[model samples]
Target: MLKLYDNEKIVLIIHKHWFVMARTIATFAALVFIPPVILTFLPLATEQFDIRIVEPATNFFLSLYIMVLFIFLFLLWMDYYLDMWIITTSRIIDAEQHGLFNREISEIPLQHVQDVTIEIKGFIETFLKFGRIRIQTAGEREFTINFVPHLYEAKEVIIKYAHEAQKTQLPVTSN
Candidate 1:
């Protein structure tokens, strides 16, 4: 949910590649089985060592481990869901979610955008049509959005809006 200017329209909204979240969920699912496996072998291991461990204690510790794991997954989901790049008719908004408490937002008027480059690094990225978009601006700071899907289409849309913004708006001048 983003607020827009009266005249400004949203040109595009980009999220990280689906595979990114998919990978996270997959890893979480795999880890959820660990407690079960450990529990299954706990009796045997304890018998072999002639060690007496309370069942209630073991269950309690495993439950705690699972709770912590769930918290980690929630944090990751927040990061993934909150992080995005918004391309509006007037500007580009980069919203970065560092963790649960911190976020940084950067805005560059399209008129000041100097270049937009797309980088697809490895086989997985290329095969999945997801990569990074580097936006170079006339100002000192650069903006990079990672794991963007439909790489070429996104680049084209950004370039198009940038060109349109440039044509309609005058460049800033220094005194």
Candidate 2:
């Protein structure tokens, strides 16, 4: 959970679509089955080797490999699942997970948002309705959220909130 300023309400919470994680899931699935399949064939290929020693050694190494693969899958899922974009009434927060330890969080006030660009590249992205959303702020910094689902809606929401924030900041004129 994230801390919010007074009167600020979360308008949207965005995460990368499930399709974005498909490749990682597929790789992990393959890792779980592929190594064992290869190991099963190893005994046939190396029939000349002594079964007494090789069996124990191979089992030990296989267990170690599976353990390492599980750790890798866990880290990969954390990287994908933890990264998020939070849009609030007052600002947009970008929370990125670089690894298990390193995380970066940045915010841009709604008033500072100059432009929102949505790009849906490739056939898969277009078909799946997920793409990249780039937010160009009034400052030098830009924030890009990739593989975001419902990008058009996100852009519209940002624009709507930005306009509202800008209007609230305007000076009142005296008659």
Candidate 3:
């Protein structure tokens, strides 16, 4: 029987770009709704409307508009937050967004991983699920994969791979 190197319990990706969920919400608020709200109240913008003639009806419509905007913003955030990629010792895969397009998938072998680093910065980042993972290999120079949650744990996973590459001749946890 072919033995797997890291079993699901021993090694796996716990989460994805989880921070993007919050950021996606904030982005929708800032990008979609805020602009329209500002335009609605602006003197030059709203001046085209006859507020005196359409007061009560306008108020109802305006409230509805705000409600719709909030819903759209929430949905937009949910989509972004949900987009994620994960890997375990058993397999590698990608979760991605393509406009309104939903999840996309991709994968590679653990043997491809060369170096890994976990970077945590800023006060909010330290408190939140925000940080980076850099993976280096002989095949590609590109590194600095961003917005990975629980960066330290991801680094540990990579370190585990390094141990396997060396046939676990040396302790991986040591500096």
Candidate 4:
């Protein structure tokens, strides 16, 4: 399993479905792209193309294409691998990859969360079991961070955790 976030008291792990979606998308993309790649080589393998056009540079271009293709695949995997949404006993975190070289991690305390909303739109989303969750905070920000895919379930978990955090908090009074 992927160890996303852990602390002394609690750990928030990514749902297994998240990794399943990532792997499924990656496999589907590979299936779609591989055929064209094979077709590109098919003519050469069968000697259908004339030798004049099949210069040594053809191999170079093919290698370059393959390189680019793998690079894209690697990036896709890395994006999914790095993307993480976590809620611990104390806080909520959103970690995302800006690119191959850049990453951003944002976090807010569970005590800051005031409300949570789950939105399920479209027939397909309802059927496929994926939606979005928006969390509202007591802070200056008017909107809560949004989480997609397992919105309803995620909201439930987050709210549960936040409320648990609240139970332990001392009431505050403004002076």
Number of the top candidate by TM-score? 2
Residue 146: error of model 3 in Å? Answer: 2.1
Model 4 residue 41 lDDT score: 77
lDDT of each residue in 91-149, candidate 3, tens digit only? 34445555575556544445566677777778877888678777665588535556777
Instruction: Supply candidate 4's per-residue lDDT for 131.
Output: 60
What is the TM-score of each predicted model, taking all chains together?
0.84, 0.87, 0.60, 0.68
Error of 3 at 10 (Å): 9.5
- RMSD vs true structure, all candidates: 3.9, 4.6, 7.5, 6.1
Tens-digit lDDT track of model 2 for 82-175: 9999998888889999997899998888988898999999999989999999999888688899999998899999999999999896332223
lDDT of 1 by residue, 67-119 (tens): 99899999999999899899988788889899977998978888888889999
Instruction: Give the Cα error of residue 124 in candidate 2, in Å.
Output: 0.8
Please tell me which model should have the higher lDDT, number 3 or number 4: 4
* CA lDDT, candidate 1, residue 50: 32
Q: Considering lDDT, where higher is better, how would the candidates rank from best to worst?
A: 2, 1, 4, 3
List candidate 1 stretches off by more than 4 Å: 44-53, 170-175
lDDT of each: 0.86, 0.88, 0.59, 0.65
- Compared with the true structure, the alpha-carbon lDDT of candidate 2 equals 0.88
- Residue 94 error, candidate 4, Å: 0.7
Candidate 4, number of clashes: 1
**lDDT for predicted candidate 3 compared with the true structure:** 0.59
Q: lDDT at 129 for candidate 3?
A: 60
